[model samples]
Target chain A: MHDTTDQHLFERVLQDNDQLADENRHHFDDMGAYVVNFMSAPGAGKTTLILELAKRLKDKLSVSVIEGDMVGDLDAERLRTAGVSAFQISTGRSCHLDAAMIARLLHATPHPEGQMIIIENVGNLVCPAEFPLGEHLRIVLLSVTEGDDKPIKYPVIFHNCDAVVLTKTDLIDHVDFNFETVEKTVKALNPKVELFKVSTKNGDGLDEFLAWLEARHSITLTASAV
Target chain B: MHEAAVALAILKRAVAAAEASAQKEEKAYAETAENTAPIFDVVKIVVQVGEFRNIDAESLEFTFSALRKEFPRTQNTELELINIKAIALCSLQNHQFHPEPANYFSCTICGGGIQNLISGKELDIVNIEIEQCLTETAA
Candidate 1:
């Protein structure tokens, strides 16, 4: 053991994650599937929103979900029951689902090609933003009950997301949630991020959200056609 | 929560790179790289911690300290984290400032709307201090 003190610029920590994410992207591109990674804090109603989306787009496009949780296939089962092909990825103790996990799941479960893969990331705000699951869209759900300052408090997730969905709007009037503040904060954080407010319970604001999704899904359809 | 996995990733990546370097050395110089590689002991790891990343340095350090022993080379490695302050830049005012007490960030200077992020999301190893075995070569 020759001991010499030498400081070497060895690695940037997330480079391996980036490589795997790239591989996931290449796989999606090859399969002609547009992947969307959905993230939110626990109880922010990500699953509810997903269920609503599946209900709306069931016939418009081929859709599937990769449910990521620390444990249980409850979400996957729910999605399957809701009439969408769903795959479960139990991350065990891992907080966030990495690209390698997605790649492995894709290889293992043969979902219909050209179907959109909506990855419902583990219910955490912080870690999921750091990981890119090779998704074309990164959608972050911020429920009204979680407070409006979430965009500022949890800035990275809000800033990094391609789209922001304000879920559980049915509780807006019942709670002290200031929609104005959330909107202002979101705009302040990321001007480019598309904002959609929806109540999965009432099906309110589902049209606009579904339209946005259909537009994105159409990109895959066009690409596949080409 | 993610810190443990992150610590593990750091060790895994460092060890993998060291091994790859050793192999390349063995192949290239026939024996020089291998001879100079010593034992692939990682002495210190410097990770740039960004405020926006939401990873607590204390938590990461604790995790790294606890998990380093699991790996071959990182048993005694010191994990050094450089805290990169999260900067909030107001696009309207064309200004950037550290969001002090930084939660619920707004432009500290001007009350601008767009808080454009300049930096502080880094998740990379800035540098690594390792034990390198040096030897005299045919000059």
Candidate 2:
């Protein structure tokens, strides 16, 4: 008799990844470090934003960066040049970096005192939104050149991100970037999201953006102290 | 575009999981006389995604179909998509509602529609159908 028994695995496929992500979160928690997952589209200024954040928060806190990319450590090298401890995870075939990759990366590196994990996820708003990667906070970048309708079209990233940074604002007037429409659209997607309009080129609005990190770092530090 | 990334993940995980299953089955059948390890044929894959997940199931399928050719384990596999609509709960009013995604919706009872997102964030592989190699010997 021919037999046919189909396997029913109601298992959540992303569950394994999420479990690994939770483990990563636990590692950071024990270290009293806050993990920030930075996500965005290509050329949206995420690397530049991260570099700026590193420079501003240099003396105040020790920052460790984990860079995820299709194949290149250019961003990691840039961060290293700036005196930041940067690690790169190259995903040859994978488009996005999963929690297991992070687990392996951190295992090979030593944990420094009072260090924060700044993870620059593979630059794609869609896939990165699904993987948590054990981040305490999620920041998505939006460059002025990219259309204002991105928030509505790619609502998942906007909705899930803890904050939105409108990058390259200095070039706002040069491009057809409508500031009001994007802000309204972002708020429509995530009502309570904290938004910052910044430009790393001319150094406009960097202080406020850096202050936001300062506030978050202090809050985490306070909680860990208690 | 995002589907390209997702499709790669789906095929990779499916292969990885099937390999583990094959190993386990081989070890369990070691005591039997016909101790041939099962070679799996992945016939179908079911992916469950939320409306708010911002993934196009059609696009994912296209991408998966294109990329499946590279994987020997899943070249002829079929894809099934389960779409989940986004839902919100008005805990203050004890009411739940399904709001249109990307819209600023308020709870009907409390006037605060964006109270909380209860569902529609799921992006998971819910099921996989693999035909196991079970050649029965004559008893």
Candidate 3:
């Protein structure tokens, strides 16, 4: 006999990934670490900003980094040379770091020492936005050299992130970047998001950003304790 | 491409769904000694892809076609993807309008910012169809 049956799933494809992410959250909570997931286009100054942030946070709090890259560990190497705790995950073909990748690393190795953990996701504006890495905060960096219209052109990334950092302010004069447009557009997309303008070359605006991070870190730690 | 990964995910889920149905059919037809175990064949799969997901249909289909061969259950399956439009509700006037991909921050009707997204961030499997066949041997 020939018979057909139709089943309705109506299931979200990312549900598995999201469940894994929640498990990662439990691991982070047990370790009492505040996690941050950073995303940006390639060469958007993510490495430089992370390097500087790690250096500053190291003095008062223990900080470690998990860098995700498609190739070499150049960025992770730089962080280690500066005496920061860093581990690298090389994603051979994947453009984004899913929660499963983090689970593999966290389970295989001992917890990296730190009250704060930073995950520098593989550089891509589109795909990275789809994956969540169990971070307390999500930041998307946009360099002035990449133009101010990026917030509007890639609205989904800006909309989903917790914050947006305007990087490479030192090169703003050389490029045709508009700060007002970027701020306005990002605000329209995510009104509650924190905005920061930073220049790793000059160390400008790093203090304010760091202060905000510290405050959030303390709040996260306090919340986890109870 | 990320589409390749997505295609694999879709195929994996579809295969599992078919296997589940086949198990039930096998149990129900067990009473007939002459009836052979049921064979399950996936016929069609419907997926809804949101505009915000930024997935290219051509690339997804190409990868799915190549991967379906690897899964015996889905070798005969056909994939149908429906594009979900990007929609936003205006904060000021409560108007709902389809926003352009480049400029989704603002509502076209009221010229006000979006309050919240009403729809279009969905990457979901709507349904799947399977054909089950039973062979009766001579008593």
Candidate 4:
């Protein structure tokens, strides 16, 4: 018997996942769909926000959703009931939705007729940040009821996301949440992260959020056309 | 837990690497000696886990230990995890500081935001130690 310690270096353990995500990006580009991966803690109102956005964008552009949950099709059922096209992926034991899951869904349903495809990732801050599902943009929801220190607590998710939607703003007055703290911490983690104060119930900042999404979707459409 | 998934990936990579090294050694030995069976045993796998990754070392180790018994090559393998500290560069003061656990957004000195993270957030399989055994097979 001979013992040998081979000097090998694999830079990232998630290299295979990243490669699959890149392939998914190419696929999304071919379909001319602007993909957004939504991540947040549980009960962050991801479904409600998507439904609101879909209702507003229905006349202008088509919107589709891919809902991911640990077990059940509850969110997908809600979206479908609201007259939006939604697909459900039950992850079973997985905390986060990996690129392979998305690839499998896409393979089964080759094309979705939405100019925008929003993937509502399994609700978790830490694990979801580690996996990228070929998304052109990543949005994280932080409700006012969840405390302002969440950005500090889960810095990676906030740092990696393209936008931070401060949800449940209508209840901001009732809660002890401080907006400035979240803004400062989120900016500290991500300098260029777009911050939005949104309340799906009151529709306070929904237009601004919709505008931002539409602008990005238009850019994706233009880029795909070229 | 996500650590379970990560542990599985680590084990798969380690076993694959051990088998690859064994195959190469077997090919080289076949030229010199015929009718010999080569067995590869994974001894140790070194993984680097960054502080920012939110991975629990004990959980990862436990999951890896539980799963390694499934693979004969890795049945007796030892998993070594090296923790890498997170260091971020403050944009305002240009200073580097260890971003405390769960408070990685702000700088320690200036309390300003970080321009970019200098280190941490690393998850990699650095190296593996393999033991190769050769025994003559009955022809």
Q: For model 4 chain A, give the 10-residue run with minimal summed lDDT.
A: A106-115
For model 4, residues B59-86, the per-residue Cα lDDT tens digits are: 9999999999999899989999999988
Q: Highest DockQ, which number? A: 4
Writing each residue's lDDT as its tens digit, candidate 3 over A130-150 gives 888888899999999999889
Kindly report the TM-score of the first chain in candidate 2: 0.93
TM-score against truth, every candidate: 0.88, 0.80, 0.94, 0.94
For model 3, what is the error of residue B32's alpha carbon versus the real structure, in angstroms, after optimal superposition?
Answer: 1.8
| Clashes by residue pair, model 1 | A12-B125, A13-B124, A13-B125
DockQ score of candidate 3? 0.62
* Lowest lDDT block of 10, candidate 2 chain A: A1-10
The reply for model 2, stretches above 4 Å from the true place, is: A6-9, A109-114, B1-45, B63-77, B89-113, B125-139
Interface CA RMSD of each prediction in angstroms: 3.4, 3.5, 2.1, 2.1
Q: List model 2 lDDT by residue over B25-129, tens digit each.
A: 676666777765566667788888888776887888889999989886687888889888878775357467765533434454554434467788777777877
Question: Residue B44 CA error for candidate 2 (Å)?
Answer: 3.8
lDDT tens string, model 3, B31-139? 7765667677788999999877768899999999999999978987899999998787876798887766355467777666656778878899999998875454423
Global CA lDDT of candidate 4, please? 0.87
Give the clashing residue pairs of candidate 4, or none.
none
Tell me what TM-score chain A of model 4 achieves.
0.97
Where does candidate 3 stray beyond 4 Å? B101-104, B133-139
Cα lDDT of candidate 1 equals 0.79
